[model samples]
Target: MKTYIHNFIAYKELLKELVQRDIRIKYRRSFLGMLWSVLNPLGMMIIMTLVFSHVFRAGIDNFPVYLMCGQVIFNFFNEATTMAMQSILGNAPLIRKVYLPKYLFPMSKVCSCFVNLLTSCIALALVVVVTRTPLTWKLVLFVFPILYVFLFSLGIGILLSAVVVTFRDLQHLYGVIITGLTYLTPIFYPIEILPGWVKTLVEMNPLTSFVEMFRDAVLYGVVPGMELHIRCIAACVVALVLGIWSFIKQQDTFILKV
Candidate 1:
């Protein structure tokens, strides 16, 4: 592990450049450039607020902020994993000619999406201010959920990048999966509206915990129970370990596959 850490550290500059390159390419032809990171989610929130706010009818005040909270977490995870899945095959030319750490390619993709997630948070904050939402000390605890989601997404990205190199079909499959998950998560609706079995299923979903945590901090302003925290931590750690292990095992043959 120390050897891997040292190697990654040695290639930190390469990783930074890869991340920067992705950010540039993402907005290369756009007029707003990075500003779209903020605008895109905000635009989605407006549409969601207009559509789902009436359909779901949650008692939660400031439904836009409530909805944006879920959007911020879900969108980050989706975007990060989607890009990471293509990272290896996308950079095949570089891998063929270079000696850089292979994992850095996917890691850089995750880092770049994280940068976008931060911008989306700015949009969320503006909504909070415009809605005149009350602030509480527990709002500071929002970082915990955000950190867990980051780790969880990073792990998933690593795993996907490793697998997608060989199973190119996963890219299409994951799009469907993410769309299903968005509805499974209580993004626009209250968990109480779910049937008991569905509620249990949602509770078991890792993203559910992160969404609930974000709602707890940003919307409810209460600290989540320790059990919830443990669950999120366990999910992140397990996914990360499995992802890293899978990548290390498969990376040896990636050159041939890509």
Candidate 2:
């Protein structure tokens, strides 16, 4: 851990460059540019609110606000994970030419997503205020959940960069998998809406706590469930360990594979 941290600190310039490259290239040819990032999620949330709130007759009051909270967070994860999948192979030139820390590629995208997520936070705060949601000091509890998000993203990004470099098809396969994972997640509905047995499975998913934690802080102003909190922490630790192990094991072969 110390070595990885030290390596990251040493290669901080590469990280910043990568982050800037992502922000620039992401919308470089587009008309709306970065606004599209803010709008896509917002537009999806609006459609969802119209469909789910009115059509499905979801019992969730303030479904717009509730759903937006989940959408914003999910978008962050989606962007981070998708970008991380290509982090290594996309930078093959740098990988071949440079001697910096290899992990910096994916972590840089995570940092870029971090900036995007911060912008979404401002959008989320506006939603909360416009919708007249209650506020309390408990909102400070968001720190813990956001930290988990960053760690969780780091863990997954590092692991995927290693795998995707070798199995290129994973780049396409993950898109399908993430689509399924999105619906399987309770971003649009409450846990109560799910079957009891299904809730057990959902609770086991680390994203469950992250989503719930967001809602708790932004909507209800309460702490997350203890059981889910424990599960979330455990999941993050396991994932982080696996990611680091995989990176260390597979990185030696990256040049040959790429």
By TM-score, the best candidate is 1
The C-alpha TM-scores of every prediction are: 0.97, 0.93
Cα-lDDT of candidate 1: 0.92
What C-alpha lDDT values do all the predictions have?
Answer: 0.92, 0.82
The best candidate in terms of lDDT: 1
What is the number of backbone collisions in each predicted candidate, taken in the order shown?
Answer: 0, 0
- Model 1 spans > 4 angstroms off: none
What digit string (tens of lDDT, one per residue) describes model 2 on residues 1-258? 798788778878878988999899888999987777677767787788877887444567678778988887777888887888788998898788867788888888888888888777776777778789889998888777777877888899889999998888998899998897787678888788778888888777788788888788878888788976786788789878988899999998888888
- Stretches of candidate 2 off by over 4 Å are 55-58
Instruction: Tell me the tens digit of each residue's lDDT in model 1 across 52-144.
Output: 888776566679998999999999999999999899999999899978789999999999999999899899999999989888999999999
